[model samples]
Target: MKFISWNVNGFRALQRKMDVFAWLQETGADAFCIQETKLHQDQVQFDTPGYFQYWNDAVRKGYSGTAIVTKNEPLNVTYGMGIEEHDQEGRLITLEYENYFLITVYTPNAKRDLTRLGYRLEWGAAFTKYIKGLDQIKPVIFCGDLNVAHQEIDLTYPKNNNGNSGFTQQERDDFTTLLDNGFVDSYRSLYPEQTGAYSWWSFQFNARQRNIGWRIDYFVTSERLKRKIVDARILRDVIGSDHCPVELELSEYYGRHAGR
Candidate 1:
């Protein structure tokens, strides 16, 4: 099975800019998950054939949201982590299959001045706890704009960007704790020393063209599913948002008919 994750920034805006459905067909992904849709349920309509659409929209219109378009129908779909505070943003969605729970999340960003850092940390802890609990039942495959540059190698000019939002030591350490618990960062695990591989770039200063960016998006899975991950890729060439799409291909080990 193959999964694709991208932060479209805004769904309606992308629709007007390019052929969204055509691009989706080009990927040929079994499941296409998107973050930061920035729209309400009634705001946009997508006619996606050969796929099932599930959306989690924020309480506020034109704000943080997520959605998944999957070829296979999930056994169950959940909108959030059941936390009222966290659910308000529509930042999370979980799809339950026979073998695993697939999640897409748009982690909150700490403002430039760090005013939201405290809330960001709180959300991280709650998110960690939520996934760990799900992992206890079955394996988990979660991906999205994690909003943290995990390690020095994850971003360009780490020294100059230190202490900055998304590159802060505290945020990085919190990410470490998540991996330490039981998840594996799929891309980094496969390409340990890969440099100049980033998913997000600043719109200003020609950052994307110069390849000055940070890899804050990821495909993470339960440690047990590591061996099943065939490939993790950053589709840098595909342009729609500040962050490009990331792909993860899995072997046929845990599909709809796996345990049968």
Candidate 2:
């Protein structure tokens, strides 16, 4: 099974630039997750015949949101973490398959002045606990814009970005805690030494043109599902968003383990 994740920045804006239907047709992905949709469901006009579409829109207009499009129907679908404090922005969605649960999240960003840092950190802890609980039931595959570059190698100028919003030490440590618990960073596990590979780039300073970016997006799987990961990719060439798509291919072993 192939799962792809991308933070579209704004679904509405992308539609004006490219035909998303045509783009999805070209990839042939089993499931695709998008973050920062920035629009309500009524505002989205997508018509993918065979795919099941699920969306979680923020209460605040033109803000954080997420969605998942899958060819295979899930056994159960859920939105948010069920924690009132974290459910407001419509930042999370979970799809339960027979063998595993696939979740997409758009983590709260710490503002440039670090005004939202405290809230972001609290959200991270709650999110980690939520995923851990799901893991106790079945393996989990979580993806989308996490908004933090875990390591120095994840961004173009780590040294210069030490205390920056997305590259702060506190945020990075929270990411480490998730891995230490049981989840595996699928991309890094597969390409440990690969550098200059990133998912999100700043629109300012001609960043994308210069390949200056940060890999704040990810596909993280429970340790039990690690071996099923066949490949992970950073699709930097694909356009339509400030962030590119990241994909994970799983072996047929997962298919055979269905209905577990």
Candidate 3:
């Protein structure tokens, strides 16, 4: 099964910037998870004839949100972590499949001024616990804009971003704790020594052209699902939003890619 995850920045805006439907048609993925949609469901006008769409919109308009467009309908679908305070923004949506759970999350960003850093840390810890609980039931494939670049190599200008939101010690450590707990970051697991492969880039200083970016987006699966992971990719070239897509292809019986 091929599962692709992207923080599309804003799905509504990208519709005009690029053809979202055509992009989806070419990927041939079982499911597409997106974050930072910045739009309420009523605002989106997508009509992918075969896909079942699920939207988790934030209570605050034009802010945080997420989505999952899948070819097959999930057995059960859930929104948010059930933690009322954090659920208000519609930052999570988990689709339960027979073999696994697919969670699309848009982690809270620690503002540029670092004003939201404390809340972000709390959210991370809660989210970590939330996923671990799901892992107890079955394997889980979680992805989206995690907002933190775990290592120096994960981002450009690590030294300069050391104290910054995405690279701060606390954020990185939280991610480390997650891996230490059991999940495998599929992209890094497949290409441990690779570099300059990023998913999100700065809109400033012509960063994308220079290839200066941070790989905050990810496809993290339970360690038990590692061998089933056939391939993982960072689709840096197919850009519509500031963030590009990251895909994970699994040997089939999982979905449309099921007959291999």
What tens digits encode model 2's per-residue C-alpha lDDT throughout 47-88? 999899999999999999999999999999999999999999
| Ranked by TM-score, top first | 2, 1, 3
TM-score per model over all chains: 0.98, 0.98, 0.96
Model 2 alpha-carbon miss at residue 42, Å: 0.6
Runs of candidate 3 exceeding 4 Å displacement: 253-260
lDDT of each: 0.93, 0.94, 0.90
Looking at model 1, which ten-residue stretch has the lowest summed lDDT?
Answer: 251-260
Which ten residues in a row are the worst by lDDT in model 3? 251-260
Residue 127 in model 1: lDDT: 97
Residue-level lDDT for 213 in candidate 3: 96
TM-score of 3: 0.96
In each prediction, how many residue pairs overlap at the backbone (N, C-alpha, C within less than 3 A)?
Answer: 0, 0, 1
* Residue-by-residue lDDT tens digits, candidate 1, 1-260: 89999999999988888898888888889999999999987889899988999999999999999999999898999999999988999999999998899999999999899999999999999999999999999999999999999989999999999999999999999999999999999999999999999999999999999999999999999998888889999999988899999999989766645545
TM-score of 1: 0.98
